[model samples]
Target: MSGHSKWHNIQAKKGKIDAKRGKIFTKLGKEIAVAVKTGGANPDGNSKLRDCIAKAKAANMPMDTITKAIKKGSGDMEGVTYEEIMYEGYGPAGVAMLVNVLTDNRNRSASDVRCLFDRNGGNLGANGCVSWMFQRKGQIVIQRQDGMDEDELMMKVLELGAEDFAAEEEVFVITTSQEDFSSVREALEKENFEFESAELTMIPDNTVSLSMEDAERVQKLVDKIEDNDDVQNVWHNAEFPEDFEE
Candidate 1:
């Protein structure tokens, strides 16, 4: 579950996610289920499951729902089996895109996604076609409240050895290497910090800049793909215009 988050304030992003909470929960629940089936239900001993739980919580998924998903994954409860798949593609402006999906029927998903691309000025490519252009990184976002001091927060982030930091107008974004993600998140928790969202995300090595019209077209294509029940995320390298309004 990822997005071009650096382009928008985390708070506003949260609002958009909230609007689609049901679909997000379904996707996250599938992730939790698959993580458990693969590694076991114990988050402590299963880092993948642990990370999935953290992401589920960040999306404001209900605690009871989270517990049920764990149980379903562990086979204590009945649930449909789902498999994870990622589709690579290019959007309207040659913007590299990755669509993450979890489904019980691979053929149905592949056909549906290909049709979406065909109709939306995109081309679904073979696996690994665009994955190389992205890097997986850990990201933690904290909203800037009235009492938060940017310098003090940045100092803490630096001391924690995050790879990068950005203090946006309404939030603080801390990024770490993949291996350091869990430790950094734990450290922040010890200091009683709350995150708007914390998880591993794909960041593009470089972004594609297009005219405003093309950028909007790409965004529209992304939205259309995301509206599908089986699509978990749509990650793209479109560099949104600074003047763009949410």
Candidate 2:
């Protein structure tokens, strides 16, 4: 992962961001809607919906709000239809970026995203530009401790159908196929393996390195992309040390 990506993961640990609450809720709502529309509302039958609900709960979303969103998505209640979109781009230092969005108006969102990229030292690209650098995967991160053995954990998760496991500083990162995500997670839970995170994420196949100055610039581009109201998630191929400061 790039330094910018690591920064995003670090930011997630910094506590609630009330200033961005509205934006966050919008994104989360879209996720719920999509999950419901795609897989139905029952978490038991729809693992994707279940994961989305879990995330919304973690964000402290109201129960009624979640239910309403699901209803809208299922067409039991009327609401605007959301379209999922992806934008590919290159940032300063030639870092590849993939931005996932949920929008009711693609033209408006696209224009806004393109503008944000231009303003932040990056430029949006054609569909396949940066997408080839990434693959969708189920990712989970377990908090590290003094005595945890990477090899042991790797063996356990791999046996449960995980594709890869990496120990980075105090974090154990596990990757799995999209279809196997829920199964692998359930297996881990059955074994009582505690994880700090469990989510569907895009993993980069390769990373682009840059000087600190260029990396900071790239981070700014990422921030701009993320700050957009229509953006749901942003993935990038940039690598930096886990302990890199700033």
Candidate 3:
């Protein structure tokens, strides 16, 4: 049991991002397109593309948009290339942070990210500086509902290759080794298990406890970083208050 629940952090993000629906969909489109570019157009054979599709759906993006995004990746956007980059850094109170970026203009993206970090009381770090503090894992969150059997679900998840399980106040968090993530997720989907969230994410090895002020500062930095079109995901290890808001 990792006993760590980033579900609240996710919820807090969702709460604030509702107003950015169009931008969110556009970013998801880029993600789907990139996934298709690298892993083929078929989600069944490409876990990364499948994951991108899932994220698009979760955001309520229309199916046609997803199909178009997939097509965009299938060579329609010739001469345009996208590169994935990982930026590492530290936030307020020494909290480690990682940013995942996908962009055609690497130089511009880097400059923009650095500026955001500088403005938010944070600074970019060397490649290996903070990345060593995180482990890539498959994380799935299933919202708690009446009649769900926790033990039974845990057993099933384990049988499907999950590495860890934690029951939080309103959700069950399931984690799997990087290699086992796709199989476990596919199995759950076959069994009709709906997920609140599912993705391959960098899980912090440990967290930094921050005062409320520092937490808010770190969160503000996170928001600013995420607002960038090139940034795909942001991972951090900072203990924060419940119900973080704008």
State every prediction's TM-score relative to the real structure: 0.90, 0.83, 0.95
Order by TM-score, highest first:
3, 1, 2
lDDT of each: 0.82, 0.76, 0.86
Off by over 4 Å in 2: 1-22, 57-77, 145-149, 241-246
Backbone N/Cα/C clashes per model: 0, 2, 0
Q: What is the Cα-based TM-score of model 1?
A: 0.90
What tens-digit string does per-residue lDDT give for candidate 2 at 73-122?
78853566778999999888888899999888999999999998888888
Give lDDT tens digits, candidate 3, residues 1-246: 654556677677666557788888888899999888888999878989988877676567899999999999998978889899999999888999999999999999999999999988998999999999999998888889899998999999998899999988888899998899888988988888887778788888898877778888998998899889998889998878665454
Q: Which portions of model 1 show Cα errors greater than 4 Å?
A: 1-13, 76-80
lDDT of 1 at 148: 90
Model 1, residue pairs in steric clash: none
- Which lDDT value does model 2 have at 79? 68
Determine the backbone clash count of candidate 1.
0
> Model 2: which ten-residue window has the lowest total lDDT?
1-10
Task: Provide the lowest-lDDT 10-residue window in model 3.
Answer: 1-10
